[model samples]
Target: NDPLLGVPIPEVTSEQSSSMASPQSNVQTNHPMTHHNNKWTKDHPLNYIIGPLSRPVSTRLQLHEQALFCYYDAFLTSVEPKTYKEALTQACWIEAMQEELSEFERLEIWELVPRPDKVMVITLKWIYKVKLDKLGGILKNKARLVACGYRQEEGIDFEESFAPVARLEAIRIFLAYAAHRNMVVYQMDVKTAFLNGYLREDVYVSQPDGFVDPNNPNHVYKLKKALYGLKQAPRA
Candidate 1:
């Protein structure tokens, strides 16, 4: 919901521009018969044809272009790799991972500690998302490393799991009131919001995949603040 949460739009390079334009010209000249078959021909006796299209029908647009035309399914189908191994193959996801870890370090969310005995250690995984704008432009590529909170023991690791979020009906009512009162309504989002909360109970989690310290490969992170996917994170 945050305005800034989106995949970074890539700059159009001269090579890409030339490549995209080259296909349209070639397709028009080579596929005359294809266009002839696709042109409108009305069935009703009284119906008449409209003027020809101003330009030749373009070769089918690329997936991203289709998405820009508001084809939701086309946008959704854009490939997103599932695992760290897969994500590393793409530059976008690699940058996303770097940004996430940088934020974690900036927030001082946790500290590396020697793995303790007799206590359960929760695992973590990376979640990949391709955030888009209303018009279907990529806004951001997000990679979140979240704890496996379901593995947590309720009595020992977490006791509460409650958090408040804005209700849609409530938001509508507030907007209506503001409109009637001739007041502007503004909204704000807290980046890393959950991490702002202090954790009451000690929680230990395994090192993130691909980021384990070489010297402390067996060490775990002792969380001082709530993290995403922790059951008590919202309540904290």
Candidate 2:
């Protein structure tokens, strides 16, 4: 017999067989199968693979496109005044207030007799700004003559300056109620919102800047109606 061919396979001992029957010993023997099963479980069909694979949809370009369109529209169609004269002419309503000021002067709302013995006379200034539409187009150039309310003393110049205004929630509830009642809510805006009200206190202000009368430079305006920047302007 050839020496290699005659060599016999060794039989497993009883100790070895007993060890193989234990769970811990079986783990070493089944290591490859265990690893394969773990991999299969991780890649199961029901697993949420898209969670790691998916990317967030980008909104940055959409916002940039909207912004570019807005900018283009404003550049092409905006109605801002090219010259100062055009801007001043757009505020012609300031001239109308001169008549009311004259009436207030006649009523002697504030003593022009002289500034009070020691008390300071509150000065006035004209404020100018451009009103714009929702689309960023200039609608009008508005001019307002206002008292320097900062100079006014709370107790001496005004009393109880707080005024009630409709809250946003109240306005929403009102709109809902109106809708339920089948009411059509019509909106109207007063051209001069403040000019509609008469001033209860004797309020005097310096003449408005651009629209002051050429003849009367020294004459200060005695306000007959509530102006835009009075300390105690009515909310209504």
Candidate 3:
């Protein structure tokens, strides 16, 4: 199911379907241009590059075709809005921002207050991405609000950062064991998981761009929990 749109996937006919069981049957062959035999003598400049004798020509042409095929859906995510104003120009982006902000509010991630004179407030930015299915179909548009942690001074804003991440070998071993046991692995993601981490440092951030509080436009948010892009977020 498509999470963002909630639209049912369109059914494909058996002839169009390509699965492990019948991979060779669905392989693309007999291109239209190849059948037409466009004029290009062996000695011609174009023929020298893409003639039947060119070993890499087929690979290069396939790559070009794949890139052209992805052109439409790639724009759905590869082109990201740089600012809140830019994002508002698109309805899908606006909805994605709203959903992210609502999640932050529900988690009680921060408190709005007057900015302290001496403290430096970290800036926030929006990031956009498109989620795809196993078969490379667009599934959802995802938006994330992240702090500009790169601007953070090392000793002042953070002490140390570390997080537990799986190693490839360990993952492979686990998968092998699972397969040996004839078990299915179930995976789940904790949405906004970073917000659940406790923040030890006194971190303050500028209000999120699009969802600023109307009553306190000048105020900043004092973070009680770790935010995405914070230096200590992964460790916290």
Best-fitting candidate, scored by TM-score? 1
Number of clashes found in candidate 3 = 0
lDDT of 2 by residue, 1-236 (tens): 67789689999998998767666654666455634352323455645444553444337798899899898756533344443344444334344345445644654444333223444556766555557899966775454456678877777766757667789999999999999999999889765565556666666566545555676665665556666667777642
Better of 1 and 2 by TM-score: 1
Screening candidate 3 with a backbone cut-off below 3 angstroms (N, C-alpha, C), the clashing residue pairs are none
CA lDDT of each candidate? 0.84, 0.59, 0.84
Pairs clashing within candidate 1: 6-139, 6-140, 7-139, 7-140, 7-141
How high is the lDDT of residue 142 in model 3? 83
What local lDDT score does residue 166 receive in model 1, on the 0 to 100 scale? 91
lDDT tens digits by residue: candidate 3, 35-138: 55565445546534643564543466898888887885467454577767877776788899889988888989999999999999999999887777998776
Residue 122 shift from truth in candidate 3, angstroms: 0.2
Ranking by TM-score: 1, 3, 2
Off by over 4 Å in 2: 1-120, 210-215
Could you tally the backbone clashes for each prediction? 5, 0, 0
Query: What is the Cα-based lDDT of residue 128 in candidate 2?
Result: 50
- TM-score against native, each model: 0.62, 0.47, 0.60
